[model samples]
Target: MAAATAETPTDRMPILAAVCLAAVVLPLGFAGGAVATPAIGADLGGSPTAMGWITNAFMLTFGSSLMAAGALADQFGRKRLFMTGIAAFAALSLALSLAPTILVVDILRAGQGFAAAAALAGGTSALAQEFEGYARTRAFSLLGATFGVGLAFGPLLAGFLIASLGWRAIFLSGTIIGAIALLLAGKRMRESRDPHAVGLDWPGALAFTAMLTLFTYGVIEAPEVGWSHPIVAASLLGAAATLAVFIAVETRSARPMLDLTLFRYPLFIGVQVLPVATCYCYVVLLVLLPLRFIGVGGLSEIDAGLLLVALSAPMLVVPLIASQLVRWFSAGALSGAGLLLAAVGLFWLAHVDPAASGMAVILPMLLIGAGTGVPWGLMDGLSISVVPKERAGMATGIFSTTRVAGEGVALAIVNAILASLAEARLSTFVPQGGAEIRAAAQRLAMGDVHGAAAILPALPAAEIHNSYAVAFQHLSIVLVGITVVSALIVFALLRGDRASSPRAKSPDDTGFDSIKTGSAMS
Candidate 1:
């Protein structure tokens, strides 16, 4: 039977490689899934709501279960969960390729999200167990870089696959990566669990999952049914009530899955802001732009992928630059400044014509990427730094949960807002038609040109495109305001924050130390 294995210097690299490979699957699935959306929709011919769930289902499950997965990793065994997760992830990817209907694909994508949570939570926890002090910092630093690699290249690779093979090739690619990671880690990694861990926080877990589900469902359905629809209103209200319950459960639990006390620290609040800020400033664009470029703008999958490369490539180098810049500037200052720069990019992007050459928008994409990279570089280290050494796992779990849950929530909100705005614009364009025009507007917002055209046979394609462009520009301006506000809040919360020298030793020699960030990713 597999048991805890003694680690020497030789064992560390293989373990790191294994987990890093596992890390790549998350962003690759995320960015690649978005990039592949148009192809998937074109082939399957699903409604706008169904196609939206193609990405939403995955993110929703992945985000909601993360803290529970982390708790399970500590209660069971990290290696056991890691292997189970990776093996299932690969199998699901293969299944996805064979899925016959969009509904089946959406169901399988939900499974993929759950598997991703297990693999990431287990593998990351295992990594923390395997390394010490500076070595641990370096290992995580490299892991963050691996995520960047996946984000930077996932769209391009997915585009190539969809163009050369089919949309199914995207899932095939995931299977291959999962298989390799499984083989590498199966024999080398050690089993680990927290001896002090108690029973799983079932109430807290249930409450949290319900809250996210309700909130995401409300947001996704709002644009379709109208925000005031009874179903949407009920879902949003339920989410808020569930959230209150979750907080209460966590606060009272003997051993909560999410430790509520962490919020007492201003630095912790500041760290959480970084991810939410980027979620708006950067991550949401990964989905929206691909839809705009491929679906609305009529660019081929391959060309859209190339455009995404420009948006993501700066992540590769700007993070390293941010890491070094932190030597002179506080992380708070750098992060706030970065968000401000991203705001500038968003403002610039709002004015660019969709029909213009790709070169016209490349600079703004680069600026947004480069700006967000600063906080992305420092975020991992700061996540654990705010807590004591023994709580490292908890800190990591909270940070990751915040980052991913924020992504799912933010994506839902932005998508709803964009669709609503498009509907409003389309109303002015086609003043006479009512329900038909509204339906077409929703489809157009999602880049479903054929569907929109079918819904409103008389509408001009140029008008559909123009409506989406104006809505997108309005959304960008809203995002700019949100980002600028978040920057000021982050700056204030982290006013006195500073990173220790990379060589600085902790009391236990196992605490987090300063580190440089590397490449940017999705």
Candidate 2:
């Protein structure tokens, strides 16, 4: 409901509070279901392959819907979109918690992602409009801090909730938190909209969404469904076609959803791609590592969650001092260096035996954390810097879309690699069989360790474990190679790029000087 007819001094604190509270959704969307996926499948009777959709659906919709939401927020009002998004997301979460089948959850979860797009775009744009100078810096810093806190402890919260309450409890919690945020915004937010805004670019939005959805679907489904399956091929072809149409649509539109001209700046491209690449690595590990601890290391959920403190806790502390580090080294150098360090951590992960102790995992985890953490302030500054002030909204949209979509794509790639490689290895272990062996192999590739064991003999189960390890190590090596290569490429591209964080006061310049003067979190 409309609360304030005009901006008032009282609106500032409530607006700030709403922005921070809304940040809770970020980590919940990113890391919440990871620790609870297996439990979700067990409770809901979904196949392992189908369960992958839970994350994919959310990611696809969230990424694809974000830019469009940003555009609409300008045309309508930020507060309106923000409150609507929070309300819809809360309702969806409650519905998700009560769903009797996986089909309903997947569909509703995707809806939640779309709802989240509105919240993210509106909440951030509202802050930029409402606050200025020193206060704006503090507000955004607090917002980023809340986001980091969510990422740092989300898994632990999931662990305890899954162990003590149930998988469904998290959804209920999401609903409650969202409702609280909605109340805060609805009571005090001063709605504002641009008078020069025109109608939305619906065709561009549709084409872009189709492109991402088709491509992600192809990748995620290819391993289980077979690489050359007609549907997979069709999906991939459809993705390409949709991408071409999207470009064509954007080229002609007066108000395009994406400004392809942004690609002109190599530095801008690097800044945008940096978050995508880093988030790709971070989300993959956050999901896969806990599964590794459970399936391979035989740790309980709580224990596995506790181990992630080494990986995530640094995200909280490092950002506070990261700007100082950036002063000594350029943001470009720090970003590349951080990625290389992450690659080293992955290399160490490849060496971990299934029977390795807690300390063995902890050390490499700590390395990964510091590696990922050092670039936060610089990244925040850099992403904002490369774009003009007039396009601040567009920059935020691009930054968020790439980051979310990258995580989704990375997940599909990881799952495909694991499933395909593991399946190949399993066939070698159990060479002579019909449907039973093939079915068991499918289960193994999906990391359903116990289910695969239940189907095969004890000796074959051990072989399946060994095969899983080898396949996982191979995937880790691939990740290392990708990270190392990306770091080198970026380093070369930014050869003379300075370490300074750009500040924005006028409409011509844009950067997170606030992040530099304040705390940083990516």
Candidate whose lDDT is highest: 1
For each candidate, give its TM-score against the true structure: 0.93, 0.90
- What do the candidate models score in CA lDDT, each in turn? 0.82, 0.73
Model 1 steric clash pairs: 315-519, 315-520, 316-519, 316-520
For every candidate in turn, the CA RMSD to the true structure comes to 3.7, 3.8
Global local distance difference test of model 2: 0.73
Per-residue accuracy of model 2 over 340-411 as CA lDDT, tens digit each: 888898899888875465788788877877777765545544554454433445656777788777777788
Local error of candidate 1 at residue 339 (angstroms): 1.4
Q: Could you give candidate 1's per-residue lDDT for residues 1-522 as a string of tens digits?
A: 124444587877788888989888889999999988878887887877898898899999998988898888887888888899999999999999998999999999999989998898888888877775556655666777778778889999999999899999999889999999998889799988777778679999999999999999999988887888999999999999999999999999999999877676676788889999999999999998888887777788878888988778877777766666655666688889999999999999999976554778789999999888878876876676665544445666778899988999999999988888888888897788677776786787687766778876677877877887898899999999999999999888876423422234444434322332211110
